[model samples]
Target: MDKKPDHTGYWRTNLKYLLILLSIWFLVSYGFGILLKDTLDNISLGGFKLGFWFAQQGSIYVFVILIFVYVRLMNKLDQKYGYREK
Candidate 1:
């Protein structure tokens, strides 16, 4: 009989990271970009309003960073669970 791959723990960890990253994405994209735009616009970044930057560029940068972070985290998790591919 073939043994099933035991990945429940790994799956849960991945889900948790996904949720956390998504929450941050939402907050940066919507909260700072729209809801708090007026307040954030007072701050300046590279000759642009902070709020505009978040909506246009900052959130994208953060998302890219999050993707790298997720990859690193998952790799570590895989190693911990002996699930790393050769």
Candidate 2:
């Protein structure tokens, strides 16, 4: 007989993924882009100051990437928890 999946563990893992991903996003957008702008401004990326890039476009790019990452993570999680669509 197939054993029942642990819903608590599944939920906990899902939440952990969310917290980690969001924290990364926040660090990049808020910490690097705003709080450390001056320090980042000293560096360059594609001809633009790193801080300026982050402030204007980096966060959006990171956000889109994070969305894809989340989708991928959730897919694996779903499969692990026997929740994936056949």
Candidate 3:
């Protein structure tokens, strides 16, 4: 006999992860890259201004990283729910 998984808990956690990750991306890309560009410009990264970096390249890097992070998180989530691929 198979026990039912707690779908409610699973989806709740998934949504939480999505919101948090998206918020972080938004903050980095829009907040730092645009709204706070002037302030961030005071700092530098690899010869480029921090703000410009985030706007031009940093956001893309962070997004790719976030993709991997989401994958790892979902993998663990699936395990927690006894989800397995056939």
Candidate 4:
């Protein structure tokens, strides 16, 4: 009998990472940009208020970083689970 491909574990791990990364994205974008704007505005970053920077530039940078992080995490997960394409 042939063994069925087991993807549930891999999918679960993928979803977990996605949820965590998305939560971080949401916190950085919404929390810093809007909810905590007043507090972060008191801090200056190269002539731009911290909150404004997060709203305009910081979040984008973080999102890019998160993309790389997700890629790396998935690669490792694939290797660990023997799911990588030969």
List RMSD in Å for every model shown.
2.4, 1.3, 0.8, 1.8
Give all candidates' CA lDDT scores.
0.89, 0.93, 0.95, 0.93
Query: Model 3: how far is 5 from its true place, Å?
Result: 0.8
Clashing pairs in 1: none
Better of 1 and 4 by lDDT: 4
Sort the candidates on TM-score, descending order: 3, 4, 2, 1
Please report the TM-score between candidate 3 and the true structure. 0.95
Question: Which regions in candidate 4 have their CA more than 4 angstroms from the true location?
Answer: 1-5
- Tens-digit lDDT track for model 4 on 11-86? 9999999999999999999999999999999999999999999999989999999999999999999877777576
How well does candidate 3 score on lDDT at residue 55? 95
Clashing pairs in 4: none
lDDT of 3 by residue, 1-86 (tens): 99999999999999999999999999989998899999999999999999999999988999999999999999999999989899
lDDT of 2 by residue, 3-84 (tens): 7988999999999999999999999899889999999999999999999999999998999999999999999998888885
TM-score of candidate 4 versus the correct structure, residues matched by position: 0.91
lDDT of 1 by residue, 1-86 (tens): 85555689779888999999999999998998899989999999999999999999988999999899988988988877778576
Model 1 misplaced stretches (Cα beyond 4 Å): 1-5
Candidate number of the best TM-score: 3
TM-score of the candidate numbered 2? 0.91
Candidate with the larger TM-score of 2 and 3? 3
